[model samples]
Target: MYKIVKPLFFSLNPEAAHHTVTGGLQRFTKIWGAKSLLKNLYTVEDKRLEREVFGLKFKNPVGLAAGFDKNAAYIEEMAGLGFGFIEIGTVTPRPQPGNDKPRMFRLVADEALINRMGFNNQGADVAAGRLKRLKNKNGLIIGGNIGKNKVTPNEEAVNDYIYCFNALFDYVDYFVVNVSSPNTPGLRDLQEKAPLTHLLNTLQKLNEQKESPKPILLKIAPDLTDSQLDDIVDIVRDTHIAGVIATNTTISREGLQSEDALVQEAGGVSGKPLTKRSTEVVRYLATKSNGAFPIIGVGGIHSAADAIEKLEAGAALVQVYTGFIYEGPALVSDICKGLLKNK
Candidate 1:
């Protein structure tokens, strides 16, 4: 079904195609028996697929990464596609319209996407509300990816993160702190050693106060140096945070086959171009820390082989966003099926 519709979707503008696909799915599921039909076609259920990570049980290790359903609106719809988990939001304490039009671009030639979406989301409260109202998550683990508001100054960024953390605390199973997005001005600056430590420590301190604290993971960038990653390992150890998401997106555009026009687009690049580097990052973190913490590998995972590479490289689980767009809905089942064969 997705193969039949791929061309039509690819013909639309990348961002428009996204809205159309998601909106269309929202509408399609309204039909009688559609949800179960989709589940039977797309979901791969097996006892072997289950994974336990960070004190939570996942039906599988394949997750829908942050940014795909930024506002938590598609949890139920996306859940039908058979992801073990779905992360919503690069959400903020307060809502803000992200970067202007054409913020998302497709490098079809490279099976990649460049987005400067600037964490455009409907705020933490709204996402929390949606999660609160979601009737049946079907055992899907949900993660809340939190970030500062665009207007939040770097000096006070911790406050912004804290606000979002508190708001979504009860709704999400885990939390991903996003301080590495290139689209957010000065946001990556927080990734520097001192500030990053401060932020995580603060969040961790608050987390400890809770009766049932959730796991907190740091989302890092692929551009970090080995020394910086060493710092990341140290920070996770010091703060006692849950783990790390190997990479967010890369700012470096080294080898892209797309036209210079699209390649030069100002934003973070995701998809195939990120494959090697993201796996490299995952391996580095896993090796550097001696596998001390879990790493959720993402970026450029268009197939189960790609997902397994990361898992072998030390990622406990993996995620897909750009790959889902390029590979269509069946990518989820294909990946799970591959894992079963390989396992």
Candidate 2:
């Protein structure tokens, strides 16, 4: 069914097609029988698929990555699609329109996508309110991925992070600090050692103050050097962060089969081409840290083998975005079933 419908979605503008599918799912799930129907078709329930990481029990280790559901809008719909978890937002303290149009592009030949979304989202308050209204999450773990507003200077970035963190504290099971996206002007600069340490430390302090604090994880870019990754290990240990989400999108267009014109677009690239590099990053962090902390491996995970590769590389959990777009809902069940088979 997805294969048949995919061409139609592919015919539309990349971003438009995204809204069309997500919006449809959102509405469809609201119908009386739709949610269960989707679950019956896509969910693969088995005790063997359960995974416990960072004090959270996931029905399965496969989760939807952050950027895919930037707002907390489609949690129920996504929950029905068999994901053990769903992450929402690179949400800001305040709403912003993000970058200008043509911000998302697809590299059809490469089965990849390039996006310069720049943390565009409805404010944190709005997402928190929506989450508050959600009555049934079907045991799906929800992670809040937060980032600074584009207008907020890097010096005051901590305040922005704190605002979103506090607002979402009561809502999400865990949090991801995003300082890796390439589209946001000067955003990646926050990934430097001093600022990165300070940011995670500040959030950790706030988290500790909570009566029951939630886990905090750092999301890093694949573009980082080995030395930078070493710094990340130290920061995670020093700040006492929960774990690391190994790899956000990459700015590198190193080896893409796509046309140069599309490849040259100014955005972070994600999908098939990212498989090897992202796995390398995961292995580096997992190996270098001696598995000191957990790692949520993401990027280029499109098949069961791809997911198991991440697990073998030391990812406690895995996430999918571009692959979900290209392969459709069946990918989730395929991965879970594959995990059971391998086990």
Candidate 3:
């Protein structure tokens, strides 16, 4: 089904096509029977698929990664699509338009995407309000991926993370500290040891203050060196945050078949090209840390084998973005089915 309409979507600008598809899904879900229909077609329910990580029970280990629904606008629609979980937002304290147009590009030959979205999103407050209004979440876990506004300097970044964390605390099931987006100027700088620890520590303090505080996880970039990953392990242990999402996107365009101009477009690259590197990151973190914490594996998951490869590489869970775009909603069921069969 998706194969037929993919060309049409590919014809439009990438970002425009994204909005159209997501907006259409949101509207379609509003119809009386749409949610049930989608679920019936896509969801794979089995006790064996359940996984408990960071004290939270997931119906399955496959999730929709952050940046898909940045504003928490399509939680229900996404839930109906059979994801075990849906993460929303690299939301900031305030609304921002993000980087200029032509921010998203498709690498058709490589079966990948390059996006410099820069965490563009409606403010955390807006997302929190929308979450508050949700009538039936249907036990679908939601992770809030929070980041600082582009205008906010890195020095004052903790305040931005705190504001977003506090605002989203009650609404989201868990939180992902986002300091890895390449498009945001100096955002990746927060991944440095001193500042990274400070940021996670501050959020941890706030989290501990809450009765039954939610889990906090760090989202890292695949571009990090081994030493940086080692530091990340120590940071997670020191801060006692929940786990890590290994990773966001990559700044590397090492082996893409796309045109030089398209590949040169400044941003993070995701999709098939990311598979091996991302899995390597996950395996390294899991192995180095001795499985000290949970890891949500994402990037380049377009098939069951891709997902299984992530799991085998020590990812407690996995997420999809570019794959979901290219393969359609059936990818979710396909992955879950594969897991069940393998198990």
Between 1 and 2, whose lDDT is larger?
Answer: 1
Candidate 2 lDDT, 1-343, residue by residue in tens:
9999999999999999989999999888889989789989999999999999999999999999998888898888888999999999989999999999899999989889999988889999999999999998878899999999999999999999999999999999999999999989999999999999999999999999999999999999999999999999999999999999988999988878888899999999999989999999999999999999999999999999999999999999999999999999999999999999999
Candidate 2 structure lDDT: 0.94
Candidate 2: list runs displaced more than 4 Å: none
Please, what are the lDDT tens digits per residue for candidate 3 over residues 144-212? 999999999999999999999999999999999999999999999999999999999999988989998
In model 1, which regions exceed 4 Å deviation? none
lDDT of each: 0.95, 0.94, 0.94
Local error of candidate 3 at residue 102 (angstroms) = 1.1
Q: How many backbone clashes does candidate 3 have?
A: 0
User: For every model shown, what is its TM-score relative to the native structure?
Assistant: 0.99, 0.99, 0.99
> For model 1, how many clashes?
0
Question: lDDT by residue for model 1 over 1-343, one digit each (tens)?
Answer: 7788899999999889889989999999999999999999899999999999999999999999999999999999999999999999899999899999889999989999999999898899999999999998778999999999989899999999999999999999999999999999999999999999999999999999999999999999999999999999999999999999988999988989999999999999999999999999999999999999999999899999999999999999999999999889999999999999997
Alpha-carbon shift of residue 120 in model 3 (angstroms)? 1.1
